[model samples]
Target: MTIPEPGGPDALLWSEVPDPVPGPGEVVVDVRATAVNRADLLQRQGHYPPPPGAPAYPGLECSGMIGAIGPGVAGWEVGQEVCALLAGGGYAERVAVPAGQLLPVPAGVDLVDAAALPEVACTVWSNVVRLARLAEGETLLVHGGGSGIGTFAVQLGVALGATVVVTARAAKHERLRELGAAHTIDYREQDFLEEVRRVTDGRGADVVLDIMGASYLSRNVAALAADGRLVVIGMQGGRKGELDLGELLAKRGTLAATALRSRPTGQKAEIVRGVQEQVWPLVEAGRVRPVVDRRLPITEAAQAHRLVESSDHLGKVLLTLG
Candidate 1:
């Protein structure tokens, strides 16, 4: 992760940097695995920079065993297997993270697979369930149904009693349907807006989770029903575009964007706490678990980035400490 400033996949290299040690209110984890995110790729490409006071390393989430605790850190013990949200430093042999951001690995899943949960789950919870306020019996439209966030959104939306329609390419439709997407739109072959209209009986969607930013702005506003909400997380296509201001006002719609990696430590810890209270028990009881597509050694980071960037994998591609 220290290969070069604004590094690319080819630039991602393993270096023998000094192992992390805990600072006050922090704990150092002996990392078992770390998950790849688009943000990491951006950072490597010199497009994204870690927020102020964040670690210089490049990983947003990781699972590992506890190694040491610093002063004032309590309620966690050495050797505990956990997954944590990090501002950075996840792509290392040992990562020092704030104790409050850590969550215990669920009863049945391996520590490695658990690495996939924290980031996506936190994102979904903050957006779909929290900001958008999706309710049972509502219609939820999810763009990018094949992605880690999309898959999680599909299952969680359906399980919450909302009708879920997803936009994915044809090849991934069947699996997406199996994962609780009530309707699927092959975005390559069909128009997402047209499909959402058809699936919602022309009422449009009650909630739309969009990862395509400006590209979908005007169309997303058009696809929403009265009092609907549109949550934008990533703009894969482009960042600037026109919005249908008339449509937004006419439909009484809501628009919001959030990023997890760049949040303040207190805010991030609060999200973690909320997840533990509301989502962790469900995971513990087998209601849902992190979905993993593949795991590779940290030295093979470049290959993992290629897999994720290819958009072929269904869930998450993780990098383990070599």
Candidate 2:
């Protein structure tokens, strides 16, 4: 897949490209499927660019079979089924992936569906579990609860014994609740702050997994418990906002933001290892599952992008290779 120029969904083109060859410590994958992510949309529109050393394509995660291994690589063989977290290039039929980023498809998960797991699983684990340190009996607030990341965070938070509160449109509330949200706030119909307060008995959320970014900064701070942590992972709502440092200081709250795509190879490897060890078991056991709204052929890349941008889907919209 190629983007001739940054613009709308039609900018995505399925054109022939040179195959990726693995370098040392890397592996080449014959991609079976790739899931669309918000980051891909940003890249397609020229608002975001792939990090240096990543491919020029738009995809961030894929599932496939190992096609080749580079020199100095070990413990993985050609023809092994795997899903991988990628910085870019997943939109293609073949992509070069860092060896450390490859994850075996969990038992009971179809190979194609596994493509949805890597990005969301790693992101939720790294930020919500590792950074936020959400504990049993605590409260978690997840914004955009109908999205791929939102759905994953909801299940994972619930599985870990935290009371999960989610913000989504009214139509998605029932499904989100079935996915383990303890409470669902219709972000369009109600004030999340008031609902959060009502649900928590005035205490506030212990941790907030935010995607709206600056637009929600103040309210997210207000929603925090004393000693709370706010993890901002996306900026869909805009990048700049005013924050009241005094209020944050008084609450003893911490604000941290992260983007997985730009991390160093080693750091990404660490997160991938952590996800394999800590999160995969839950997936294999069926405590969490991929929420795929629809699957489209890779050639329908533009349609897939439009689906994601519309935000009408309940979960991930996947693009599968022939």
Candidate 3:
């Protein structure tokens, strides 16, 4: 897919593009599937662009078979089934991926569905587990529980022995609970901060994985437990908001914001390695699995984007190729 001009979902033009050649330490993947992400939507709207040296197209993760390998890349051979975390270029039939970012498909996942795992696994494991250090017995509050990141975070938190609480639409509450959410607050009808307090008996969440940035900033701070950590990964609600440092100080809370696509290749590789080592095992063991709402052909990416933008899907909406 190529975007001649950035605009709405229709801006994605699935036209011919030159084949990608693998550079040193990279491999070319004949993409089988790719997953739609909020970042893709942002890029489509011209609000976010790929980092330097990345493909102009938008896709953050893909699953496929290795079609070629570049010099200085070893331990991976052509024709191996794998998935990758991409900075961009996953919207096409093929993509060149840094060797370090490739991961073998988890033992039980379908090749197409495997595309759903890389981005969400890396994001949640990196921020929620590695950075925030959400320990066993802690309470984790996940905003946007029906999203790819939200669904993955909910499951990962549960797998790590935390009590997971999520704020999502009432329609998604049942599914979120089935995915291991201990409490589900309907964001449209309930005040999450109040609900968090009620559910935790006023202790609040020990860790919060937030996506609604500025709009939720104050309430997120107020919902934090003493010594809490809040990791903000998206700005769907807005980017500028006032933070009550006094309230954060009184709670002894910590706040961190991160973006995955802009990270250096080496850092991304490390996160990929972390996911393979820690999260892949959980997946193979069936403790954690990819949650896909539906799959659409690559050519219908505009429809997929419409579905995601509408917030009607429960999990990831995948784009597939032959």
Candidate 4:
């Protein structure tokens, strides 16, 4: 298997390493496409090392056909089209994933496009549905509206009958509005808190999906309504800050922080099961679709690294094997 190295993108060499075989309860995929994510960037930077026993290759999720199943694997076949949440090894042409982590690609969507699904949808659904308990007819705020997770959040929040407010660049406002952002605040030109307050009639949002961590922390709390839940999925801005615990407690807000890549296999499998039951139907019915920013070859991972590092991509970016 030839895969990108962990440490700088410059160290991403295509070396022919040993191929992987599934252990009991595992399955291997013939990868068709893999999506680049912020975690992939951190892994390449050496700040985020794969967990002990996790594969060293960078990919966290992928879309592919099942090549083989290991002992004890069931309810799946050799020729299934699967979009998998991998425990690494996604950058390689062949990746071994736990059987329970594999989700069947929706019938009408292309497999390569399905590569864009697992991480973003799982992130949005897990944080919004599982953690925050977002309810219908409430207001939800999503930071980074043009991102893969944001796109999914907008659609999912809307499909569940929540009014959505998204922070985006002005260039993305129209697109976000079309995707069900009832209010779009261009972060470059306006304050998200003010716009959200105005849009929600000064009641604040019922839920907030935040990628900007400490930088948005106080402001996010300020933007939450009574008993609002704030789920923090990433700290793209900065990590440390002093919070007004008094204000948070007064508002009765709850904050939850989580990461998908570092989760225990059982926990991830449970998330996969929930999404399969609740979210996959939306995909099959075309109410939700993977938003692909672009696709490139896996061998050109050097270029792929540049694309993600630039932070200019609007949605999920994919890399395919030859």
Give per-model TM-scores: 0.97, 0.99, 0.99, 0.97
- Top of the candidates by lDDT: 3
Local distance difference test scores for all models: 0.88, 0.95, 0.96, 0.88
Which pairs of residues have clashing backbones in candidate 3? Answer: none
| Candidate 3 structure quality by residue, lDDT tens digits, 1-322 | 8889989999999999999999999999999999999999989999899999999999999999999999999999999999999999999999999999999999989999999999999999999999999999999999999999999999999999999999999999999999999999999998899999999999999999999999999999999999999999999899999999999999999999998999999999999999999999999999899999999999999999999999999989999999
* RMSD, every candidate, angstroms: 1.2, 0.6, 0.6, 1.5
Q: Please give the lDDT score at residue 90 for candidate 1.
A: 89
Q: State the RMSD for candidate 4.
A: 1.5
- Candidate 3 structure lDDT: 0.96
Question: What value does the lDDT take at residue 162 in candidate 1?
Answer: 93
Give per-residue CA lDDT, model 1, range 61-147, as digits (tens). Answer: 999999999999999999999999999988888889999899999788888999998998899888888789889999999999888
Could you tell me the TM-score of candidate 4? 0.97
How much does candidate 2 score in TM-score?
Answer: 0.99
Model 3 residue runs over 4 Å out of place are none
Once fitted onto the true fold, the runs of candidate 2 whose alpha carbons sit more than 4 angstroms away are none
What candidate 4 gets wrong by more than 4 Å, as runs, is: 1-8
